[model samples]
Target: MARAVVRAVSASPTAQAGGQVEEDPAHRTAAGLLASHPWHTTPLGVPGGWDPALRATIELIMGSPVAMSLAYGDAYTLIYNDAFATILGGKHPAAFGRPAADVFEEAWATPGVGDVVDRVYRTGEPFREAETAVALVRSPAGEPEQAVFTRGCSVVRDSQGRTIGVLTVATETTEATSRLQSLGELTGALAGAVTLDDVARVALRYGLSAFDVDHMTFGVDDASGWRVVRRVRGELLDEADERLPPLWRRLPLDSPSPLAKAAGSGTAAFTEDGTPLREVAADRHDQRQRAMAAIPLSTHSLRGALTFGRRHAHLWLPAERAQLTAAADLIGQAAERARRFETQHGTAQLLQRSMLPEHLPNLDRFRVAARYDPGIDGSAAGGDFYDAFVLPEGRLAIVLGDVAGHDMHAAALMGQVRAALRALALANPDPVVVLDGLDKLVGMLGTGTRSHELFVTVAYGLLDQRDGGLTIASAGHPAPLIRHASAEGQLATVGYLDVPTGTPLGLGGAHRAMTTALSPGDTILLFSDGVIERRRRELDDGLAALAKSVAEAVSGDPRNLCALATSAVAGATEDDVAVLAVEYASTPSRSATMNVPPEPTMPGRVRQWMKVQLSAWDVPEAVIGAAVLCTSELTTNALLHAGTAARVHIDLTPERLLVSVQDSGTRGTVTRAHTDTLSSRGRGLGLIEELSDAWGTDPTVRGSTVWFEILLSEDRENP
Candidate 1:
């Protein structure tokens, strides 16, 4: 008991006149009397509702010694005793029957009261006890202190319940008593805090130390009532006096202690020491704390209480009690923040997993490893990718390219580019033909208008197991670096960078593509600009660096070359880089250069050659007549224009049957319909146009290769 007393004293500020609420007892009583004279009365002003007799009765009652006040209006009047007028200090007797704002100008002008008055007037509903504190005058020697009040006001209604005028009442509470009650309840609720235990502790300590409480604790609620979760007190309560009594104990929810009331009712309480201590297990020694307050922490999932035990009966003040309420709010916010963090983190992880690749293809004679690295900044998913697949021909086609930008839209475009590239490659193995087909697929270019600049740089090739080599072509993309194992167990460069070919797949023009062959024990590395090139370095410099790296890595084993290159560029490359390499074990043994010897004869010469080559390539006799006519027209056009040297060449593979006519001069386009005119002598080009499926020209530095192609039959048969 002594220890609890000491604790309470230690927590509380020294009692003085200038505490949170200052008492001016001598002036307080006089102020009330001076404002209560009959001269302060004013007559009721509304029509039949304001009866003279009733007004007199009301005035008599108002003048009595009651704590409440009343009023009526159009012209707002004061129908109250001196107690009411004393609340409006320095007001004259004539202030009655005046507007509320005029009489209590200083108070009504405050922002808080203005908002309250607006609600009352607009809703026509009572505005109950609005709390406020004010220090009207400064002290001569010490800090001025607040005088606290709780006000309730409403409209008075007629028989029909229609609002006729306003009525008001004000109540003054013991500031210390109210604050102690509020603090106890706040801490009681905070005791059961889970995520906010730290916040709860801070509130409890502040309540006990700053509010002069003898013993204070936050406690968790259970069926048994409140269990002390945290407690702070002075030496008395801390003592080990078995005979005296235990100061702290868990009480049943139904017990008449403040903690039990707070937990069961989920409400706050203020009680005096004199209240009967029914069902309390504490003895007189333990019950020495004369004042008590408990506030429930019902703001979160857990239930708890802030319980206060004070040695000095009236330790809590209004300002300290408000502080406890604020502390409880902080604890609730912390708990909510923790919950949100966990939920969001889980969602982010799920989204990332859904976007990653599910499986990678297995290739023969080669070990392949692919890596996708996202940008480190706040960028989302990107558009860089590498893909490889087998063509109908035995050769493997590989590709790597970037969409125009980064983001979901760019990733989507990357997919479109990849799918289109694969389809075109399979349809026609020639890299230039595949890209030209893509332009047609995208709906940009047509035979009539051939100037659309829509383009993407790509490098594609067919890996030939028959020759142990790759026939590769490029469309404005970086050349693949070729590395081969030398006889000395060292690596060396194998091929030069293929020049930009056939104006990237999308652009339409009369352009030619070049092919390079790879031999046995060689690796061809295809990559995007992200690899090899740094911002400060030109493409040639970047390519040189890549060649050096590949030559060294390919020396020992081809299987780990991919992993090695990935690590090398991972730090050096800032953007997405994709690398795909194909190496063969044995080299092919033959080389053939296809060249068309100059043709001299006109229409007849074309007819004979087309028949021989088409038969050699096993073109069916069923289409032999059509093939002969197509060759006749193309060769005739070449003969008429060049007139010196023109020839025809034919090649057949499982994918396509291609025909090319070499001529000496750079000539204009051939329109077969005009050539087939009634009086026209040139029926050759017209016959070729009607017979072939599709045809175009490859404009070369020396001359153009006028060519066309036909898709092979299902069995690739001559029949």
Candidate 2:
């Protein structure tokens, strides 16, 4: 039998042969290998001749408390150790000389063991898990229970510095694991709680009961009134607790309260000698003076206070203050979220009413209906509006328009334009006439009044039911819809050709056109641009929708038709919208035909119409000369080329005069040409091209209409 002896980890030891040895970091590497790698019988790697003394020392190392083994190739053989036989479950000691994989195959299957071993093999880094679970073999009829382990690792090396195996040492950690579980449960109970009141109760019950505290309370500060959220009292609290006032009501947001200052600065104010209570007494009204600490409960802008007090004037402990300070931060986070929620709710209400009308008008023919629907997803208001009133001629002048933006500024501009349009229209009954007048007045309305170009698009109409007709005009506005009483009534677009109507109000245009037609029924549809402007679709799609809705609702009264149009547009998208629908009692038929008489030469008729248009446009005498010359030349072009029936329609507005010729011919493009030697016949077309500011052709089902415009002095003054 080979005798075994144990030596201490230092250079010398005093262990008898065949007994246990104390394990420590210095020799843990060699001890772990001999215990697990049980079957090796190679010569010791020490140099032979000079280390006989060391070889004898290595032999004596075998008598340690740990199991002893050696491995050669794949075979593990137990060398000699009393501890080696104890770990074999019920197997006899004869089982010692076997493969290491076969002996501990079940142990290798334990969770987390394989991963640790693989890290040591691949990266050569010793990995340790603290308080990890492990399984150990027992006697017969036994079940495995979890056991905690602290593990260490080291790489085993042969003489050439090549890794041969890995060594591991593990110790039980069951007692430490149980204490950690209890601590986690207590912390979780405090973190998951809500409400300052509940938080105070939890703090008092757990913090005071465990730490033996006298009092605990939570403090909060915000825009609303500030107050002490809670004050704890118990059986001994009456005697132990300092007689403290309701601190919450006394400390307001504006006051210099200790909790408010600590919360605002996000700094913990702690003093064992009652410095916090003394500061509060000096700055505010506090009767009691005892040991107090303000644990700052602050996150972002929300502040929370955890104030402590003792019935006897004893100083607070540092450890206790530190614990409360951490809890204060958690409380502050919850308070911040609640404060933000309350602020957002208030902001929503304020923005909702910002765009609504300050007051409604009271006019005889104006039965105005207005509706404002703010966006559900945080948008306040967009620009849409309607206005109406009885003009001097008893005709109700109705205007509907949209400013181009969708903010408070857009809505404010919308209101200003709407009120201006009504005032101008009331002073002048012509829709075209009123708009031209407004164009001149825009410059006088201040720079802030006109913040953007192309600020608005409007459709204005003057309804003179006393005369049984409506004069309609537009400035880049959607067309007014007309529905009749017939069963198969198709929605008709009533006005004639519309030009880019004076460049959308704000861009400095000289004129707007006023076209008139007899109202065919009791209903007329007037709407803002939103009725025919939709996203993800062409402009034609909105036009088609308006026509379809009007045709569907034709048989219904004006109120229903208006409702149908609004519903149709509103259902399609989220956008600002305004509409005005006026209905009058049905009237009997008027005289159908106008009496015709023989007239003079076409030049005379054209000249007379030009003067009438200039008067309506309110053009000064200075610009009338150019307008007269342009109108004459256009009429001559129509009479000469098409041999067509010609109708001259001249519209006079306050800003400019427009003269158009409707001819029975196809649209012909005009060319800029050199003037010929003053011949009367051909010079007319050249002169018209030169004198007119701008002109174009509108091709319709009947034929083509060539039109020209002259900028009047009125536009120059106002625009």
Listed in order, each prediction's TM-score against the native is 0.33, 0.33
| C-alpha positional error of residue 12 in candidate 1 after TM-score superposition, expressed in Å | 50
Candidate 2 off by > 4 Å:
1-378, 440-454, 487-500, 518-520, 554-556, 569-574, 587-719
Best by lDDT: 1
Residues 63-150, candidate 2: write the lDDT tens digits.
3333323322223222333444444444434344344445555565666765555556456564545567666454444666455565
lDDT of each prediction vs. the true structure? 0.49, 0.48
Residue-level lDDT of model 1, residues 312-423, one tens digit each, is: 5564556655555444443333333223332443343223323323333444443233444433221344556677676675566666665444456545556667777777
**What is the TM-score of candidate 1?**
0.33
> Which segments of candidate 1 are over 4 A away from where they belong?
1-363, 376-378, 441-455, 488-491, 509-511, 554-559, 567-572, 586-719
Model 2 per-residue lDDT at 486: 47
Candidate 2: C-alpha lDDT? 0.48
